[model samples]
Target: MSTLNRISTPLTELTGVEHPIVQTGMGWVAGPRLVTATAEAGALGILASATMSLRELEDAITEVKSRTDKPFGVNLRADAADAEQRVNLLTKYEVKVASFALAPKPELISRLKEHGAVVIPSIGSVRHAEKVAAWGADAVLIQGGEGGGHTGAIPTSLLLPTVAAAVDIPVIAAGGFFDGRGLAAALAYGAVGIGMGTRFLLTSDSAVPEEIKRRYLEFGLDGTVVTAKADGMPHRLLRTEFVQGLEGAGKLAQLLPTLRRTVQFKNMAGQSWLELARDGLAMKRSSGRSWNQMMLAANTPMLLKAGLVDGDTEAGMLASGQVVGVIDELPSCRELVDRIVDEAVVQLKAAAATVRSA
Candidate 1:
């Protein structure tokens, strides 16, 4: 069967999106340009709204609409104080999908659904997937330990199958997926699609500095480390000296500097100190993390904003997936998506032939 034949569902059909692949909504990463490029390339590209101000977020949605008429998704923080406002912007834009960085309330889901948005949340565990599926999430993206940013311990190989078995909704596998073989593997494991983060970040279309992208290319698969110090939650990142230094320093030892950096980040991100602290506290409470962890958690998003938006390497954190090591060249979004789809088709066919021969 053709690779396209392997995935024919409401997701691909209703969205009018061609490929099953998705460019995940990465904070300070996936923006209007990247999202539009992905949608134009036939895959669903999700706008990362967690790092945006409410004004910036709306402008981004407008920018994406200006670029592509194709279907696209907007990634929002479910717990943000302005989440309702974000949802209102999504409805105004008539965005095809709304993906959540944090699990949202059922009422929020209902509100978005009523406005004709398909909801998908990134889940790290089966229980979370089941809960969201029951709550009316159209689908779930399962990112494994190999993913970037805040991630879970289960690898995609294990987690994808588990979540698929536990939930009735479609599962999009993520983490450690960088090539066609991985896409074929995900399909074999019953995932309807694959979501990519670092792979997309390494692409030429990404607005990140060339130096930063090169840094990602230099690593091997083992070069990335999952450190809890970036945020209160364990986050996958490139093993930079900054992260190593923070690791050795006790949480209390890092508090003052973290606070100082938080202020700087607030200014850089166009947020007030009060807003930043409030967001930090909200994040901590939602994650069930402690005060120290919550305070430290500010580092990741702030650093990411600095790196991507301000091009300040010293103050920025590069939250990259393990797949970063394997990506050597930066291809355009169109080239990357087409190559992945074509290669996945070829690979799946070859695997089928081997099974038939066997």
Candidate 2:
């Protein structure tokens, strides 16, 4: 099937985007280049800002705007010290959507919505989805445990339906989604669209290191593990030797190393210590994590940056989805999105034919 073939679904119109697929806001992974490309290719491309400085975030927004005229969103930590700055940038830029990494405050949602920006927060449970929908969020992205980074315990098969049945607003199913079959299945479950993180991270447009991306392709479906060691919350990541070591490092010994690592990262990134601490505290409070847990929470992104940017797999963590093993090659954003849509259309039509004959 031609990759351009698309599924006729509400997602195409609801988000005012061309496709029913979304490239989720992956911290440090999804940047201006990838976001703009995904948006231009007809999917919601969200700029991941949780790992960026306020200035870096604004520059990224500008970068994406420079690349594509299509509608795109910025993913922000709703509880950041500079959240106001990020929100202001979004409003000033007239960003079409604002996706929260964590459940943002109602006022934050209202503030962004007041500026004509649609609010969509990724949810891990039925309650989370329902609560946000009731709060007047434009939509919710329901992610399963199989998703990368910080994720909830619910499976997509169970969580998607639960959230869809409970909320009146749109829900975009995420986690374990790689191709059209997943999209068709999500739509069948009443989801307007499918959100993807690992799938996009493995794409040609993704700036992740070539070797690291290759490692993702080599792993199998069972290659991932969910661990709380990175942050206070559970996160999905590839089970590498370093990850195993980190996991075994236990909570006590991890603090000093993590702090040292964070300080080094700040230096490398040229961030002030005060700014780092401010962002860290904001992240901790937002996630309901303790101060110590917040300090530990800095490990995951640092690990990811180590592997993705520094070519040091042993020095960092590699957060990836379970779908990483199933992905064998890196295709351009257009090619990847088109292929999945076309494949889904063919699959749905074939199923329809079977029903008709029956």
Error of 2 at 20 (Å): 0.6
List residue ranges in candidate 2 displaced over 4 A. 1-4, 268-275
Candidate 2 lDDT, 78-120, residue by residue in tens: 7777788889999999999999876888888899999999899
lDDT of 1 by residue, 1-358 (tens): 2234334544686566888889999887899878888888888999998878888988999999999899999998887867888999999889889999878899989998998999998888888898899899999999999898888899989999999999888899999998888988999998988999998988888888888888778888888788877776788877877777766878678788788877766876687768776776677677889887777766666677777666666666778888887888999988888788888888988999999999
Lowest summed-lDDT stretch of 10 residues in model 2?
A: 1-10
Query: How far does residue 25 in candidate 1 sit from its true spot (Å)?
Result: 0.8
TM-score of each: 0.94, 0.94
Candidate 1 vs. true structure, TM-score: 0.94
Error of 2 at 39 (Å): 1.6
Which candidate achieves the best lDDT against the true structure? Answer: 2
Q: What does candidate 2 score in Cα RMSD to the true structure?
A: 1.9
